[model samples]
Target: MAGDTKERILETALALFAQSGYLGTSMHDIAKELGITKGALYKHYASKQEILDSIVERMNKMDYERAEAYEMPETEPDGFAEAYLHTPIAKIRTYSMAQFDHWTKEPFSSNFRKMLTLEQYRDPKLAQLYHDYLATGPTKYMAAIFRKLTDSDDAAMQLALEFYGPMFLLYSVYDGANEKESVAPMLCAHIDRFIAKIESGYRKPHAEGA
Candidate 1:
């Protein structure tokens, strides 16, 4: 029963936070929504910030794991480009896209999205964590993968950005509130286009061991 209560509370809070901005929500709201006493809610989560922080932490851990799974192999092709195109980096794209879809489709996805937008201006600390995960961490990871695949000092980083950039932009514009079908095709098309671009960029010019 205690376990069920904890899960219920978290689920309810997640939905609430994603639907309404953190500032707009109160502990009382959560308690009222859950049909529980404020003290019972407090027992589950000490504060709203604490609950939000926990959700963000879980998201961070999932992202790190997602990226880590794409670690490039050591014996990859001379530039690492082949391995990247053939293996880990490809997997990363698939993984990220799936994660995006999951978040967008989940019951609390709206709340999650809402919290993401709200946190940037409402809390610097939360924003920093997001910056680290979405911007800094993924950018660095993609850059490394690109470096390996293209054999260019900065080409890899640029390629990584180019490849995944649209997915972010598309999500930013749509935000999953509506037009699910209109946005879905483009989300994948952008990835496919980037893959082709990367392949063209990485092809060896004038072969024979120059």
Candidate 2:
């Protein structure tokens, strides 16, 4: 079927893109890998850029779906921290592990991540995608959630950094290995410290106070 062929082309292209830099992979390579002629590939994707665009679109949609599924507390500021903290550690761990698996284990996702990582430095669009995916997008979303609790952009951003920073570092070290078991505890520890800081009404000390 036409749909199946298009899907196959996309999957083959993703694998090739991950193995070779986006700039290095060509239409002929994708066509050959898919056991299709260049003209046949054109019927599905007019150009390599079109295929790349499709991949980015699909992955972004997945992210949007995940964000939509995440539930945020509706409690008051005084109770927000406690409510968020009371969420079972097992639930948090499961979410964290799911994210780890998404980036490391899922074939399409893993290849797409690697492709973006490989091409980010060379392409402006890819660079922006990398930043949006790994940093600004999640940070901004969390900042909005935290703002409901703190009512301060600075405080919200600080909390987002404290919470997501360790997880970002963990992603770098995670290679679909035993790193998950080793890092889950550290991730939970960071969460524990972050919650403790929030409960303590943490504030930056002035030079004079110091």
Number of clashes found in candidate 2: 0
TM-score, candidate 2, is 0.75
lDDT of 2 by residue, 1-210 (tens): 988888788889999999997899999999998888899889889999999888888887876565345543445554654455555545555565566667767888889878878988999998788788777876775676566456589988888887887777776676554645676676677777765665556322221243
Per-candidate Cα lDDT values, in order, are: 0.67, 0.73
For model 1, what is the alpha-carbon lDDT of residue 149?
Answer: 54
Point out where model 2 deviates above 4 Å: 67-93, 176-181, 192-210
* Model 2: how far residue 36 lies from native, Å: 2.2
Worst 10 residues of 2 by lDDT: 201-210
User: What's the count of clashing pairs in each model shown?
Assistant: 6, 0
Error of 2 at 108 (Å): 1.6
TM-score of each: 0.76, 0.75
Residue pairs in collision within model 2: none
Model 2 C-alpha lDDT versus the unseen true structure: 0.73
Say what the RMSD of model 1 is: 4.4
